[model samples]
Target: MSPTFTMSAGRPAPLGATFDGDGVNFAVFSEHARRMVVCLFSDDGKDEIARLDLPERDGDVWHGYISGLRPGQKYGLRAHGPYRPDEGHRFNPHKLLIDPYAKRLTGHPVWNDALMGYRADSSRADLTFDTRDSAPFMPRCVVEDPAFSWGEDIAPRTPAKDTIVYEAHVKGLTWTHPGVDAPGTFLGLASDAMLEHYTKLGITAVELLPAQAFLNDRFLVDRGLTNYWGYQTLGFFAPEPRYLDRGRIAEFQQMVARLHTAGIEVLMDVVYNHTGEGNEMGPTLAFRGLDNASYYRLMPDPRYYVNDTGTGNTVNVDHPMVLRMIMDSLRYWVEVMHVDGFRFDLCSTLGRVGEGGFDRGAAFFDAIRQDPVLTQVKLIAEPWDIGPGGYQLGAFPPPFMEWNDRFRDTVRRFWRNDPGTAPGLADRLTGSATQFDHSGRPATASVNLLTAHDGFTLQDVVSYDRKHNEANGEDGMDGHGENFSHNLGVEGPTDDVSILRARAQRKRNMMATLLLSQGTPMILAGDELGNTQKGNNNAYCQDNEISWIDWSQADDAFLDFTRRMIAFRKAHPILRQKLFLHSRERAIDGLEDLFWRRTDGQPMSSSDWEDPALSCLCVELRTASGTPLYGATETAIFAVFNAGEAERITLPEVPEGMRWVWEVDTTRPDALPGACCGATVQMPADAVAVFVTEVQP
Candidate 1:
């Protein structure tokens, strides 16, 4: 420690440790804290060098300034308050806590009984507090110098209508790649191989699984498994240490800058609804030790936490300082980290209020909506939790796109030839009009996807009828019970050539449905390569080969198909529209903006939609109704979706000097353009054929 180091009262405006040229200022929020002490650690972050009590308190914030302290200093906080569990106050000064606003973490928490404030084996369970120094077991927080040279970096700002999201994990995407020098790290994600793949696949943004600092739960450690998905977030502003090469924050910045250079935006999957700390018996981490009742939503007993998120404890987002903390973290990512967007995990829990309630006008929603920085970036919501009224599909307000599970289930049942699915498929193919047409939201309000990280892969969806999760150590009981899957004929891996061919075509049909639909399309990272978890839908704890993308087993044909489909979607403006299509007529063109039909080429009757035996659907898409003259176009598109046997389809009539050009045929992936279509055509079984109108030059 510097002999000239001296402490004095500091400003409490900024809530984290800030480094100035001459010194560092530290501030933390703890409403019930009697005293807040900043402990300076040795250069190795092992031994304590200095301990100084904060000399100032403004409202709930305690602050102090240490002169001659450099930017490379390492420190941790200790809060002193009453340890009354029944009244929701659990503070132990012996347990070191990480700052809620920490932008850089030294490492993860080392698992130990001393880390917990309450004895795990105690019969009284949290009613009794233990006194043990935990600084040796906890990772120290560092004072970071947030300086970077982002030369000529710029966000792509891709519109929601044209955006295609690729959901990936930092480790899974590159850990098995042959070209990445630093596997399972942020530098690997920015490798030339990864950037080239994203560009080739027409991906506009990469939605990464949680990249924030997280804890590997003690229970998971005891089970010999790991939290591979990183949902147990510990530090919001800091990048996950495992993803960085040398524990420097610049690696994350380098990744963002390089992705921007390739015209790709970055989206983070964030979990703000819960924390790593479990219920009453959980460890005394940052929030629990600083001010328990103010940070978490406690139950009536004030000892147990509200488990609305299915995680142990729900964050008290309704509290003003807690809400401010979340908002500040979000803004930091946008302003400092330069991330393009966020996909909130279990977002419904963020809106929970008193007495089993959910409000659309909640303060969290209103705050983000009004913030200038947040409104500009993309915001996707998972839209559900385990709490009351938690299934809030189509419930979020404007500027937020939601994950639409209805699209996934409906499309799966439709392609599986399930009865009574035609109408539901029609509704989904047209952007789920019944669910998203209200509140002045656009068709892009629903993010349509056939598969995601939590469910079966695209290949597994057609290859496994039941979830095989015995490998998860849960006795086949952890994942979803009903996956809406089909095995075609045989289960798991099969040598039958007939079953293999059917599975391939089935995969194409579903991917085609997703690309041609009128909404944002998100592809699971390795689905294009036919990646499988051996039918384990819940591989959240498997960080081994089961979760990693095996590049050696790449399915070239499916990869080619994915690339072509994304290009096809980008080429057609009529498919990606901001307005929803009703059967209403356009005033200027005197034609219906959208039309549906059966295999007979005639307009579909109400009975056709209700027909259990109906095996196909046809649609003609045009510029949406009420589109201004500037938004209208001359091109029109026609498509056929056949899930059953071969059939003949009549074409929609074309205007004078106009011809329908054969654009796509899933059965013949090598099919070329400029093939003129006739009035009638023979469509293959279980295939999609798309045509675009061109001038008859």
Candidate 2:
């Protein structure tokens, strides 16, 4: 019995060192590199045992076979190529590179200038490259024999029309929960208590913020603030070690298993558009030190990076190897991590072509469309970036859902008492059919959201008119300037009872609008409990109590109201139709499929939308077939919204075999009024009411 496993050169078909029980196969994809060497490291990561040169080249892929290497063996890649930056080739032999297709990673990277292929203090910067090997500082990839017994776990495959997304942070979600102690980390996100909370919330899916292994910005770390949002991703294949338990992948798998068992889907917000390496002045972390020209989009002169993502360097998706890396990363998350979907950040960057125009048939899009496993899962796109022609919201092909920023902005303005917003609000309520109808995409193609992770919470929107980002240390300039929010008379905290009542009403109106809209709605984590960032719209840097979900601060009344509103949405079939109503000539009772009526029950004329003080309006929605479900005939629910001083509006004529029942009165407690008429539906100033007419025999 030999202490060391037998070692020999083997054939390379699959990239990265593949270790079968019999032998090990080595493969690396470096098109321009003259020679590639596989570096073996000991347990301590300080000593390098061997550097075997790979001499076989089949096409652009470099492959060689070695027998006797075990699965637990740690390794890295050292590619030999030219270090020319002007020609877009910044490959340095001195710096050890990670395999783009690595499966398992051991640890996290500790920032140091030694990790850079170029000297930090040198005035010449990347031009005057350093020759130090970075294997000591960087995390090495491990070759593990992939094996798992997924006894009965399966992707719930919740239909898009029925999906209710809850955008949450894996760490922030479970960290503060008193019951979820040991497993609040990434591995612990699927604890029984936490899963039960999500299941109870009635959310079909959880869209977690970026969980890809990331590093805190050096500047932010110097200021004692970390990138808590995890938007700065470094490793796509490996989960961040900070979220893991004892540097194991099993923790992540366990979380997925539990969530699946609980009938909830997981969607990862992936940031592949940019890397953590900030700018040209930033450290040479991975891509820059490995192959800067091939991995990133450099300017024509080659000194600066193409800042399309608004995050320093934009990835060069046009390159085959870079595109392959993204595809591999996505597959890893789906097959290994058991994620149900991915919400691509700045997805437009992934479809860019050489002509500087967005390409619908780009290799990346084509690959995902054709990939059997990926095509089956949900695909969501942020749909825009800061680059030229970046706002490609409706451009994604069928089967891909996009974050409808139009839906967000329009809803914000309308609820904030903005003038003449009825036209825009109508489009948003209809799932932005104008934008999505042409792509063979149903209404579900528009992921309607009023609030997301980047902006103000639902509570802050009704409380603050301007962003209060002074705590971010950026002197209030870090967040967005133009916030479409109304203070409801006084800004921030107020003791006035009227102001408190108005704030509560506004929150309900916003939530109800989102839930009742045609598309899939995503509620920001703490919004349901009236969470606030103290009016700070951007809390990316605030990892303290300011960003945490305060479970103790929940108002009992508001929580109960939220439960009722969510239940109302799930219970109603007309609110979530997959198809858009044709606008041509159909009107129920001479009213359109959806009609805007004034307080007097008269059809809202075009001029009525221009009324500034006109705070109240009613919307009547009906299904296309004049019936919502097979058993139930179509019933129009008139949602009366009173943004002005409360006034009791007379109820419309109750149809035959139907009596209106007070469903949800935003001003009152969770009480269902027994009598339909003569009930005097008291709508407090700045409140909304949902009066339902269930057909009676």
Candidate 3:
């Protein structure tokens, strides 16, 4: 009766909602569903266009082909089965839902009570179903043509070791920059001038914050703010419509192409762990309303969802059909969107299994490993979540890089004047081999960061002791308590020269540690320019000037200093290493390439390391063997860190036949200066000195 054609149900080989341009083909793989129907929505979403009952049923797949439809059509699904909460089944057909295979989403969902599958005010949620058509409030899936011509533009293909990543939010990066006319949007980022900024900064890749279609929570919108961070993703495949300058979805793809031509790789921070559809009491925008049981991993009792990500709903990554949907979206980005890599937000959720534990051999992990296209691209993992055993820092398998929290904490503490932090500081400066050694990964496996979008900028890390998130409207309860941060002397801004000097030196010391460390360092946007969120670590809700990068506010001095620091790191080899170091082995001859010494030019004693007042350490590195670590070649360098007040540091004696030359000094008279060699360099207090010692010919 609903204009259905008789076609044999195809094999369940290619899974997910796939459209072939002729008509919409609905296919869902649920080994236990009793019935699955495809629901169509009108343009206004007030009336149901049609409900085509899936007549054909294969082994575990329910699919049917229908004609008289083209790309850009909107539809959803309603799978009905046993409503047994105790058995982990929550099949409700009353709430209209989204097709998991949707290639593109039309717009963001309108938050309302009608979008909820269960009565909002009721005590019992899944027990009593609310017979409401949620189509009016939910976003619709658009049939995409999946065709684009990317003429001559290929991924930058920069290897892991050679690549320098710049982590930035699309809107936040260029939002307040006066040069960018269209501030706080996608077009601003794609502009040629913005690309030039990165090119001049010497960053090879731009890891953008989530650009996927996301939701601004009802509470956030009501408070006159929104989820400015974009971590709470709603649709994996669709770009956020608000980000697009033009209505065409292809504009997002075009941005990637433009970046590629400039030799800059584009990596997306994706959230597959959770969706905007919150809990049983939350709205049913897409997956929840269509087939709650099949799309989500409900608790053994169906009334509740297992909140692993702390975002209300956890996607069933272990589900075969749902698993394929994620993989398909990933491939689409690489093949269709032309993205170079992905940084998985709360990646631990993707590795979860039956007992609600993270399984290394989860279906999602295996799928990515096996996919030829995906395997070739860069895959980075945030590597942890709120769930049990979620802190899988260096536990990820090969071809994966993880954020090193230990490195971040240690570096922060050492530079913050914390007592007895020397030993731990050295380990982190060498790339935290203790965490990543056994994983058979290179030194670059650890993606070191002193600051990211979730925390304070490098400038704030040395100027704020506590989070000032009152602006976020969370009563200052949001963000992490243990930030491992320290304000030099004053809690916030200060006119005291002593406090200001301490903050500047702390910044220099931390930057030196990050750049000199043997790993891939990801510099947060605006960090080099001394950007601050006014101590607001969790500015996820502040979409105003607080979150935007004020390019105009950046001084010439800060810009020059940042450029020199980046250039100095790129010019050295001892900083980046492919293999972890062996403490016993001499790097060249009888003398070790790396020598641990005190500020007195003597071998460091255990007691010296234990001293809380010990304010300085020397790291001497020799790369004379011309050994190559990734793309960086050989060079000898020495770094000295003084975290104390203005005091002349007794310079360590240069090795025989080698003269120490100052490559960079944090307290230089000018922001950018030439290297000075073979002199008693007046080391400024609370400053970092990088001296290059080359072999005399």
Best by TM-score: 1
Whole-model lDDT, candidate 3?
Answer: 0.77
Which residue pairs clash in candidate 3?
Answer: 85-301, 85-302, 97-290, 98-286
What are the Cα lDDT values of the candidates? Answer: 0.89, 0.78, 0.77
Measured against the true structure, the TM-scores of the candidates, in listed sequence, are 0.97, 0.93, 0.92
Report the C-alpha lDDT of model 2 over 1-697, residue by residue, as the tens digit. 2234434455656667677787678887777777887777786666777787776778767777667677777878887788776676767777777666666677656667876767888888867788776777788877766656677999899999889999998777777777785644865577777877787778889898988777788777778887888888877777776787676777777777788888889999999899987777776656775577778888888877898899898888889888888888888789877899999999998888864878878888998999998998899999998889999988998778999988888878877867767667777877898899886689899999888989898888888989988877888878878778888899998899989887887788888788878888888888888888898888887777788888778666666676677777888777887876544445434434676777767778867876665667777776555554535644766677665677766566656777677777776755665345543456566667777676765
Badly placed stretches (over 4 Å) of model 1 are: 1-4, 586-591, 625-634
Q: Residue 487 CA error for candidate 2 (Å)?
A: 3.4
Screening candidate 2 with a backbone cut-off below 3 angstroms (N, C-alpha, C), the clashing residue pairs are 9-65, 10-65, 10-66, 183-188
Top of the candidates by lDDT: 1
Model 2: lDDT to the true structure:
0.78
Task: Please list the residue runs of candidate 3 whose C-alpha ends up more than 4 Å from where it truly belongs after superposition.
Answer: 1-17, 41-47, 356-359, 495-498, 586-591, 624-634, 645-658, 669-676, 679-682, 695-697
Model 3, 666: alpha-carbon shift in Å?
0.6
* Model 2 ranges with Cα > 4 A deviation: 1-12, 494-497, 582-592, 610-614, 628-634, 648-654, 673-675, 678-684
Per-residue lDDT tens digits for candidate 1, residues 1-697, read: 5345578998897889998887899989999999998989988998988888999999999999997788768899999999999999998999999998888889889889888898777898688778889898898888998888988899999999999999999999999999887989999999999999999999999999999999988877888888899999989888998999988999999999999999999999999999998888788878899999899999999988999988889999989999999999999999899999999999888877765677888889999999999999999999999998899999988888999999999999989998888788888888998888899898999999999999899989999999998877888879899999999998899999999999988899899999999989899999999998888899899989889999999999999998999998988878888888767675656677788987777898877777898878899887654232232334678889888899989999988887888888888887776588899888999998898887787
